[model samples]
Target: MRSDLSRRRFLGGALALGATATLAACGYQEDTGGSGTSQAWSYTDDRGRKLGGDRPKRIVAQVTAAAALWEFGIRPVGIFGPSKLPNGEKDPLAGPIDLGKVQSLGNVWGEFNYDRYVSLEPDLLISVMYLRDELWYVPAEQAEAVEKAAPTLGVDLAGVSMPDGIEKFRTLAKALGADVNTPRINEAKATFERAGQNFADAAKTVNGKTALLVSATKEGMWAGNAQGFPSSKQMAEAGLTFLEPKAPGDGNYWEQLSWENAGKYRSDIILLDNRHGNLQSEQLKASYPTWRQLPAVRAGNVFAWNPETPFYYEAATEQLDRLGSSLRTV
Candidate 1:
């Protein structure tokens, strides 16, 4: 599921970057790059409604976006899933809302309760995706349903990876009343930009070498071919070469790569995307234990796939910013 999510972001980037560059480009440049205050923060829902007020007080956020809100002092009245909350959610607005008091809008792949949402009487309804990437993570119909109940603000953050996700988060923050256009935003942007540059520089030093992003699970193993996970795309974007597998058109971008075949790829780096499963969990520590057994792991070139952002919200941009910092440390 995580692999598919990244793939979606890369594939969608072609369209999203073009169609909403004006919006997406926010907090990414000095002077707002001529977008101006007219292009100020606002929620662009699935239905294309623009939602903003002088001060947005009541909010209903999706799980990931809800986390972003916590980062910026905006407490959501409700969220999509209970498990989406961070560790301290129960104690305060720092995490997920109280399950008993807050209604379970829906699961990661289900519909939200429209009637209950209306009862909650939120000023704005938000959609966040840090947990799941697929649109089905929360039924598309639910977005529309919530819109009907109130001023639903659906930030379709599905498949938004790393730095891009962080940019999206800043935009969401501004819409929710954070001073995203302030010097703080600029500092954050500078930090993230430097991180990307460092990643790019490192990739260049390893010039012309290829890398692979794969995950091991109890079920088995999954490897990204071309048109797959954004992690692979990210490495490629950072300037490292990739021996992309021939994935059939937009179908399943991922295909199984046996460990034997995996070694044959001759990748300079191996990014292991650990997951929950017997085989994958075991593989996490046991798959490549011996130093001389595998070259990349032996050379300390193997990297664990680290999630940079909250995968599911407006503050995803902040998460992306963190990605650069995290990857730099790695």
Candidate 2:
């Protein structure tokens, strides 16, 4: 079960000038080189860059970004991200997009096939950016090549409120021809707003109980930093008090701790990373006597969490509903 969530950790390098020239030589160009499409369309991306050209028809995007667009009736021609589960389960981040309709460039980070991507003749490339790193979800090593292949737009996953991020996606989708006024689309948005209010109301009823989000592996446990994650911040806004590490170990997103020290934090509820499965947490509890001693763990107040969950309205509603239910029981 844990196999699906084991991502390859790679150190990204700075973009090189030589790579840019090589991409240009391969016939890759920006949106400025008109492809004979309509010129009345333009979009300002999360990076504040204005991209203009005929509405992009052949779009390539990161899987999560693709998910957000799909909710608004926009679909990408190509997507890249983690592969299906070992048992061939669909990735939740894929959202409502049918995987069979799009091309999968590669599954792992830093492993995109440049030749294949270029062959697709994409008019635009979209990805989520980690603001602090100043890098898009596209591996830094492959950034230049991907950018050269088409005009690139990034959606910031940090440095903004979750609602802001979702709005950005909506704005882009509208610019790309999605009908934002459609009943279906409006209904999804309305549902999410109500879910958020429900979560907040439920949280207020819990009497200030605290929750901790964590990811566990055979190597160790990692506590999520609410300050670094938009979803966590949104949950905080909904009245959930997330535990912040006194000393974060991995940038501002996570704090590493051994199983022996996992019980140091006292949380009323535990939100475990469920992207892979819940087997890891069970194994940890069986291996370490202290692991089961956590207040949340002992009380069985554990809930599933996916840090990379899609920011679309439907997905947001589902997640908030789950959290609201847990808060009510608390």
Query: Which candidate should be chosen as best, given lDDT against the real structure?
Result: 2
TM-score, structure 1 vs. true = 0.62
TM-score of each: 0.62, 0.87
Model 2 stretches with alpha carbons more than 4 Å out: 1-38, 132-135, 277-281
lDDT of 2: 0.73
Evaluated at residue 115, the lDDT of candidate 1 is 76
> What is the total number of backbone clashes in candidate 1?
25
In model 1, where do residues sit more than 4 Å from their true spots? Answer: 2-43, 46-56, 81-108, 111-119, 128-136, 140-144, 156-161, 182-185, 225-234, 248-253, 258-266, 275-295, 298-300, 311-330
Positional deviation of residue 28's Cα in model 2 after best superposition, in angstroms: 13
lDDT of 2 by residue, 152-183 (tens): 77777764556767888898899988887799
Instruction: Identify the candidate with maximal TM-score.
Output: 2
